[model samples]
Each structure stands twice: as C-alpha cells, then as structure tokens.
Target: MSTVIELAPGVRAGFTGRDGGVSREPYATLNLGGHVGDDPEAVAENRRRAARGFGLDPRDVVWMNQVHGADAVTVTGSGPAGDVDAVVTTVPGLALAVLVADCLPVLVADAEAGVVGAAHSGRPGMAAGVVASLVAEMERHGARPERCAALLGPVVCGRCYEVPEELQEEVARSVPEARCTTDAGTPGVDIRAGVTAQLKRLGVTNVTHDARCTRESTDLFSYRRDATTGRFAGYIWKA
Candidate 1:
C-alpha cells in the first residue's frame, strides 16, 4: 500500500515518498515528475500507483507545470492544468497534484465546501505569495479560508537549505518568517514555516505538516542533496 498522511474529513490529501515505484536509481522507485529525466513510462506508472492510493484513477488526477511562481489555476477536468504552480478543484474524484523534491508541496482543503487545492511553494513561489493565491482560488470555488486546512509536505529544512545572504535577505523581505540561520550559522530560509505563517495570514488557521526534511530523510527525494534525483508529489481530492 502507498503511504499516505491523513488530513481533514470528506477530503483526501497526502504526500508520496520515493518508494513503491518502478524507476531505477537516481529516479529510483516512485518518481512522479515527468520533467526530471525519469523514463516516461516509469513516471506514468508511478503516478498511476499514487492515484490508486487515494482510490482514484490515474486519468482523474490533474498535474501542473510548476514554474516556481504564484500562478494558481482551477482544475475542471483530468489533465495538465497549464503552466501554474497551484491547482484547486471542487470536482469529486478529480485529484489535484503538485510535484516537488526539496521545495514545499502544500495541500489545502475545505471539506465542508468540497473544495481542495495543491500548491508548489519554493523560495520564489513563497516570496510571490503562492499559498495566498491558492487560498484565493479556493475561495473562488466556494472554499472559505477560515474553514480550510493546509498540509505542508516534506521539504528541505532551514538548517539544510543554505542560501546566499543576499538571496536570503531578498526572500525574507517579503516573507519575514523565512529568515533564518543555517546549522553552520550561515543564511537560510525555512520555507515551510513561512508558508504556515502565510496560510494563517490568509485566515487558514488549521494547518498540519510533515516535519521530515527531504535533504535529511532517505525516504524522500531532495534535489539539493541529490541534484539528479526524481520528484515526489502532494495530492488532494474531495471524496
């Protein structure tokens, strides 16, 4: 069975790990990212398995062409939801997925409203307010931010995600919660923390997280730790 993290009721949202897949090393096992040089067939099969984990067909899941920006799109059917970093949908059985390695994959849902969303929040995406944009898109679909719950998936932690001082400062300017010092006492950013803060700022108070740092966890795929590695996914759908 595929490992899944529990979220709120009436909705299914979870993250996939680097297991139960058919790819070889580097992209070993469950690599869901098609743009990461993994064999297309292997990636396809991995995605199929992921969908099955949620009791949905592979063709019913909508994946995004993430560009590390704040673009959010509403998914109306099963297919690619254009070049956006986040996708929200109210359609039952239509799962929305976001791919990530070191970056954060955020899943949000308002079970009562039957609206669900998934976002890819990297340094650039967070600084650009991707989470807030996602909540707004969810609201457009009748989801209330106050009633929404968010889940932050596995990602590189602040201690492991060292960045240049200037870049860190640039991101921190917009997301003050992102500012931090690395384990080595150099500059870094805890994007998950920032994302959580952003979610609350947008009135999404119920939030959960997978504290597993991708760079530190062998079960996860981290691009910063392994540049040639594959990517995992965060998925959300209404039951």
Candidate 2:
C-alpha cells in the first residue's frame, strides 16, 4: 500500500508508491524521472499519473537540476532553476518536486503560514547543508522555525546504505552526529539522523520520518537497490 505521512491536517506528502504506470525492465513501472534512461513517453506518462494521483496540475510542479549542493531557491513563480538542490514557496498550487533514487527527499511545511518546501538530500548536499538552507529560506517567507514541521521521506536507511571509511569520516566532520554503525561492524552514515539533529538544533517544530527503507523495499525506486533504476518523487505544496 502507498503511504503518505501527515505532519499536520493540511499538509500532505509521500513517496511515489510503486506498482502503477508504464515502463520496462530496469525501470519496471511508475518511473517518474526521464533522465534515468527510461522511454521519454513512458516517463512523461508516469509523471502525468503522479500529478493525477496528487491532484496537482502537472505543469505547475516545479523541478530543478539537482547538483547535490546547499543551494535552495525560493519560488515566487512557476519554473525551476539550473543548479538548485531544494525549493521553498509560499505560493499555493505550486508543488515542489524532488526526484530521488536513494537520496532523501525531504518535505517541509508550515500549514498555518501557507508555506511548503522540498529538499534533495544526497551525501554531498546534506553535508553542505541543503536542508538547513531550505529551512532558513522558509523562515524568510514568514514560516516560524518552531511552527514548521518536516518529513524525512523514503530514502536509503543506514542499515542498507554503507559507505567507505573516508566518506564516513567526512560526514562526521561536516556534521558530527552523522555516523551510525552496527554491531556487525558495518560502518555508514545515517542521513536522516544527521538531518534530524540539525533540524532540532534549528528549532524545527516537528520532524517525522516515513520509516521506509528505499534500498530494502522493492516498492520504492532506489538506484542503490537496483543499480540502474527509475526515480520516485517526494513532493509538497502549499494549499
């Protein structure tokens, strides 16, 4: 079953629950991103299906060329940026969409303030402070830090997502609390844990996690889980 986490009554967000649309083999079905070697037509149709599922205007959903950096753009209009890792908007009906494979697609909203934001938190971007950057921009739009709630969408959980020692060291240096190792001697970084601690430090009101491990679950698209795979999206919009 597809799951959508409700941070508050008016805020709605979820990962693209698999098992629908048209794609093949590596992509299988319900692959929403076009850049992953899927058929363009199939990708377009998949996106259309997602729009219909979310009850959103397909054209109004904003996207960005993710560079895995800490650049968050504030959307005062429709259209996207060239090198943005996150998007925040106070405008209604404009859904902020982030395409992710194993990376965390973070959704944030201030229901009462009519503000919503989405961030692409891969290794580099999370290390560079993408989520924090987005939260800062959301505050600029009149969303109080203590009133905005965040949802860490489906991603590669620490257990299934392993990393090299150097990379783990880098994560620890960038954000000290990012390391989460298991008793079996598997060393890795937990993006959710790191980001959650950062959010708390920023005074974010509420932060809830979807708890779906993309790499471990075949239901969600994961590049790490399936070497070459489709991108399932996690998006949010102000209504």
lDDT of 1 by residue, 64-167 (tens): 99999998988789988999998888898898888999999999999888888999999999999999899999999799989988889888999998999999
C-alpha positional error of residue 49 in candidate 2 after TM-score superposition, expressed in Å: 0.3
State residue 129's C-alpha deviation in candidate 2, in Å: 0.3
Each model's lDDT comes to 0.89, 0.83
Q: Candidate 1: lDDT of 75?
A: 76
> Model 1, stretches more than 4 Å misplaced?
none
> Model 1 clash pairs?
none
- CA shift at 27, candidate 2, in angstroms? 0.6
In candidate 2, what are the lDDT values of residues 58-111, reduced to their tens digit? Answer: 888888889899988888776765589989887777888889988988898988
Q: Candidate 2 clash total?
A: 0
Q: List ranges where model 2 is wrong by over 4 Å.
A: 1-5, 182-184
Q: What does each candidate score in C-alpha RMSD?
A: 1.2, 1.6
